[model samples]
Target chain A: MTEGEFKIIFTGPMGAGKTTAITALSDQECVSTDVVNTDLEQCDKALTTAALDYGHIDIPGASGVRLYGTPGQERFRFMWPILASNAAGVIVLLNGQHPDLDEHLSTFVDAFWEGGRMPMVIGVGRLSDDDFFTIDAITEALVERNINPPVLSVDVRRKDDVLLLVEALLCQIEVNELGLAEA
Target chain B: MKQQRLGFVGLGDDTASACLSMLKIMDGRSGISWSLSDPDAADVLMVANESTDETRRWEHTSKPRIVVYHHNEPKPSASHVLQHPFRVMQLLSVLEDVASLLAPTQSQTPLKTDLPPSSIQAGAEAADVGEFWDSLHELLYGDFPAAAHWYVAQSDEGELWLDARSRRFMADPLLLKRMMHHNIRPGVLRACNAPATEGAVACSLFAMSWMITPHLPAGLSSWISADSAFQLLRWPSFGSLAKSRSDLTLCALLTKKALTRDQVLSLSQAAEDDTDRFINACAMSGLMRYDKADLQTLPGVSAEAAGSRFGGLIKGLRSRLGLSA
Candidate 1:
């Protein structure tokens, strides 16, 4: 029997729009494990996805895909690998306004990078025209680790934008499978 | 699990059952994973020893084969085989051997200078923009003292001011679009000491360089030396730029490891000009490094992950979303 169901992960620091991205693509409303914010130092949001975000897309004729978003807090680090295991790929979203933009990028990239075995695409939200070039730093950082995946500027509110990340993830997987049919 | 398709030919239903059972028994422990498939679609074939018809039917195929022999029958292939009543380790051993054969392409292989490079296939004829663009390219990619701070590109339509240090430039969006669409009249770019100090579309240095690629001449780009091996320093954003299929494949391959121009041609399903254009885009965008550094990309999918479930799943997801792979 085919393992028809697949998982794609959306993860990043708090308020990076994991839920918003999922909601953009999900067939139904995303199920979130929300908690009143206690850690205001990390983010100023009223609520946070403390456990995970769950959503699904119904494939036309096959068992669909499951989308999981890891909690943004470092306290939930243990869940990252568990969620990543057997995932098709990951989308690491980042808050471009955050002061520690580089740090969050480094942390999530290091955490889920999994030695580059995991295919990842990064989407940075709210990238202003003045700071458009900072995206290069994110791209270079991945290169420093000897990994280069697509780093796109995105707005999670746009369904097309979120889908671009998904499409890129699929491209990443197909590229990895390039020699499959070769003799 | 490293998945590859295993097909059976002329095995009795009982023997097929035994093989599948043994495969399941070895699951998690078997370094190479197998899913049952028809012989036509299989990556490697396991045939019954006495099945001459089946063996003859597959003789012409380049797909690797392993003969299943009874303890008494003579082996056809010297290396790959299956003893009757498959043992878990024995099946694992044969699969691992086949996996090794299908691997090594993805592993680290030093660049070879001996291999013959195909002649550059002619693409579109050189446009009038080559002279003007090439000079700007020289200044952009080359090291110069006056250009130490920056340079402003002067053209008939508008001025584009660029800062090499910041990877940013300022130009009118309509002018940039006209350039990208190849609608701008052919003209030379003149250097002005003072950068544009007025209203215009602020853009990444990559955007203008990438946008101007189509208007540039097509062939092996001079920037990527034919003799030296190179790889990407970073991937350019697929954002805001047109991405061809060739672009994606080249990005996927070069991002993993350094390759000579021909090496890239041999490995990718891209045309010579498309390859040149893709590399040129990377170079002008400051995403390509000339000298090859020791780069290692893991063989994420071993020996036809296309034959595996995960590979199928990825394609399926793309298909479901109405996106072509």
Candidate 2:
């Protein structure tokens, strides 16, 4: 990674829409390795990402943003550290409608935070009006686990929403990088 | 463009006249036009505060009756109900409901012109657009488990796959560009994940847009947790959308307190998936508000009273069907 370039990774459970968010924000063609989903019992979707998703966005005067998405299944856990290496930040997306939403949040947050706390943001999707897991509740759960990050409600399908996550992550990275330079 | 006749029986003169006035206002707003006179010829009957005897007599005649009552009174037996002090939106919703029942085979017919005429183009083009959305609604909400599977796949795969159900592909090879346009690419990709042919990708993309574009309200992508509490922003008018009995019961329960989806389902006979869809639709339409409060703990209802209420509701439903309890 060059001085002007930074890498951001997206990680979440099988149906959290991380790949969709990367596709929404990527400036160029996205590379994906989705295969026929044989794991229908665990996730009701027709397909699943077999490998990593890759895309890039140009940052003015900066080297640019390289976006990577990790496969959501646990079988691909080995790839998480590989994708997170040299990454400036991680964005965690969770499916709000999932029955075990809190568990999903805890699992992903722990995985990403293991490499020493990187600038991270959480985006939750597919919420209904009567949903029990609100932003505040999620934030509290994170606080209880001693991992505090900016949590947001997002729809990966919307470009602006995806961009908002990117912008928040970049801002956090800049603050941390600047603080290190001053020290 | 079918004319339907509606009549009110057993309603007080004041209530009947008030209802008639509201119907007149809704005459052209809804797809169906209405006539107030001639109860004998009415395709649907509105029975408000009618005695059990009168309701029984009307029930035997085979006309679908909408029973109206106050909150304090015991609910009557009928497929539909309208509360006192009606709103125009509620009345329009009921009329639309009856129209759908009367013509279940006319799936392509536009239920209501939700958009104003000036905004919608006239003639064949307008009808085509209406029919397209109607089909999409059926595809998404109707009994096709394949559509649900596609939705789950899209949410999982993001932009990597295409839906086999879509009928057109974007002219541009840049799938992301097309995806950015409609924001449903993830689901599209998932639906087409196992497509037998490459052409299925394009077809599924086309179908995906048809299904998603018209329905995407701005800023509606947030996830709803199964345990969250909710408040109703507006009264759900009966027969407005194709709601099941469980959907109606859930809506009614929402009027009382901010209840979790699980709590609501536990109290009613609604299936888990249908309750989820109903809650999503309500949230998207701005008919509900998410409450931050945890689920409220209430005193247990005495078994005796609970059984009586349950029995009465069931009996009313049975009586409406002209079946003896």
Where does the lowest 10-residue lDDT sum fall in candidate 1 chain B? Answer: B113-122
Listed in order, each prediction's TM-score against the native is 0.65, 0.37
Query: How far does residue A130 in candidate 2 sit from its true spot (Å)?
Result: 7.7
DockQ of all candidates, in order? Answer: 0.12, 0.01
Off by over 4 Å in 1: A60-62, A129-131, A178-183, B1-127, B141-150, B164-168, B177-182, B185-187, B223-230, B244-246, B260-268, B290-308
Consecutive 10-residue window with the lowest summed lDDT within model 1 chain A: A174-183
Show pairs that collide, candidate 1: A180-B304
Candidate 2, residue B240: CA error in Å?
27
The deviation in Å at residue B49 for candidate 1 is 88
Worst 10 residues of 2 chain B by lDDT: B148-157
Q: Indicate the residue-level lDDT of B62 in model 2.
A: 75
User: Per-prediction interface RMSD?
Assistant: 18.0, 28.6
Residue-wise lDDT of candidate 2 within B1-325, one digit each (tens)?
A: 4788888878876567667755643444445678876778898888876567666678667777788787678866667888775544456556766776887654443233223222222232222322333333333333442332121122321333322132223222244334434443232121222322222222223223423433444322245555567655433322111223454445445533466665556654567666665665565334567756463453222223242312332333224323322
